[model samples]
Target chain A: MHELSIAIQIVEIVEEEAAKVEAESITRLELDIGLLSGVERDALEFAMEEAIRGSLLEKTQIVYNFIKAVMVCEECCNEFNTDDYFNSCPYCNSLKTIFIKGKELNIKSIEILKQ
Target chain B: MCGTCGCGEDEHITYRNPNNPDSHLHEHSHFHGDKEHSHAHHHEHDHSHPHSHDHSHDYLLKPGGGALNSQTIQLQRKILSKNDLLAERNRGHFEALNIVAFNLVSSPGSGKTAVLERTILEKGSDFNCYVIEGDQQTMNDAERIKSAGAPVIQINTGNGCHLDALMVNKAMKDLKLPENSTLFIENVGNLVCPALFDLGETKRVVIISVTEGEDKPAKYPTMFETAQLCLINKTDLLPYLDFDLEKFRQIATQVNHHIEFIEISAKTGEGFNQWYEWIVKHRLSETD
Candidate 1:
């Protein structure tokens, strides 16, 4: 799955941070994965488990904060939640709309203990 | 997810040329997110710096029990920023070389390779063409494109589902990408994962054959939404199947307001002129 690659990326980023700060072990890993970010949570968590072996994040607590998919209707400025695309404005019945905030995958923060 | 050995860990991604056996194999490191391309690659950050940290990212340090200090680094970095940055570099590279490239996306058996074969064969005389084929395993598509009389490289992604910008950048260097030519990157067959990655192509072309459902656009909306063109392959089979062209166009347009469609059959010479016209027009518009 693509999640393994994403997990590998997470591990790489954390490893760089850990190395820069001389962290013995990363205690926690938090990620902001929006619904529209096109990543599955359980799949990512499972991949993270495999990707962290023998790395600085070997014992890190992985926390995922899934953001809901929300779109703003350009016609009426109404915000609506939908899992799929092809959404029409519920309030104005207009097809003009775009995603506001559900398409980001970011590493929020990391906790590490300096040796 | 490692397809080759099934060890659930990624192996090195390889690029091979079926036509040139002497220079067929080129292997690269699997550290996708790391800036290092080689095992001996050094980090720019000094390992033994005296100052705490001087990075652009925010730092929050609190005293731990005794001498050991535990700190929280508030780094709001995008996961694919490395890939995105590399993709932008690739776009600049293409601009510098005056090359027009397209990242073709589609499901398996959607005739992506077939479309590539035909496009190269038809347009080879007009302008130079090179290809990079991506799959979990095998060099089948690359060989086929080679048969079409073009320099081609096959990127075996191991268990990876899609081709990242790093893979393409490496492949371009190996391809000896010429000036004022065309490059087509045939991504892996899966429509879901490939939608998230950008290869820094001039445009993305998503293919859907008439044999598949018209609801594919509605089903995989992100792929359609990101693509600039949708090539409906296997139009010759439309007579037998229940696929509705009008409905498919409507649904596809619903997801992507600007996605243009061209119907064609790689097997037969149907709607090829328009496809060629698209290649020429887009190349002029993008490069010139």
Candidate 2:
């Protein structure tokens, strides 16, 4: 699905960054995919396996950090982890909640090898 | 890489005008991070030109790893930044051209095209509208919009689930949209993927029919959250279906406080007046 596109984007961004540094190859790629980012991890991983082939990331170890969605309840002033945005607060059963995390889709870092 | 760029032919996104049916294939690989990605070609025209080129610098083609060094580069960059940057460029272009662009997003069969068709037909002699129809693979919507008396282009994203800003930019180029006009970009019929992609539209209108139920807002909160206007379509069918309109509004408002509601029926021409008013309000951008 869109994970394929996201994987392609990841590869493109990492490759571009590596190119600027004149890196020969990327040894590792660290990705931060929040649970609420709407991207499935398995889908992205599968896509990455195909996306990295014949590229600098061919031999690279890909690491995925699936961040959990953190929500802050406006009623109880308590913070909690949720799998989705619609989850009511566990502590207060309040629907008036603000999302603090788990929507992040970012490239945390990359281990590049230079020649 | 299609012999020159590192991209394959499958990565090409086609923009086709329904009236003409001639597609313009644009490569997405080159449009990723840089405007141009160039690497020295080492393969000969004849032989087994091994596709050994890794996505790295030119030196990787050579042998020695004796001078190879590895380092952990810390860059917490958003992966979609490339798309976002292009989206901003699109916004700038629309601003310069004085074109008010609206990104229409919804699920399949939610009457996005129907809304456009009715809007274009009913809003006659008022504003010039250009349309960009995005689907996985179909010219049906484009053809429908063209028949609705508006210049339309169809973007058939082969395997792409959602339309990105790059695709919209390319389509915009092909459309050659007139100044002081309206551009309706009907995004691929998906609530999940399209939520993350910013197409730089003046206003994002998310459409949902009564049959979709109230849970749609809660299920796809991101889509509802990001959108500024939520068009509740198929009000005519509400008499038959036990669709709770108040609960839907409640859930939608909870997800997006700033979102405005417009109950429209693209079929019976009911509530087209409010839709047109909303369009004019956004086209003028509330400055007036």
TM-score, chain A, per candidate? 0.89, 0.91
Tens-digit lDDT string for candidate 1 (A1-115): 5676677778888788778888866777888999878776666666666667667776577777888889888779999997767888889977777888778799999988765
- Model 2: what is its DockQ? 0.40
Candidate 1, residues B198-224, lDDT tens digits: the string is 888999999999999999988888898
Report how far residue B178 has shifted in candidate 2, in Å. 2.2
TM-score: model 1 vs. ground truth = 0.86
Tell me the docking grade of candidate 1.
acceptable
List the candidate 1 regions with Cα displacement exceeding 4 Å: A75-77, B1-12, B32-65
**Model 1 lDDT at residue B240:** 96
* Candidate 2 displacement at residue B217 in angstroms: 2.1
Number of the predicted model whose TM-score against the real structure is largest:
1
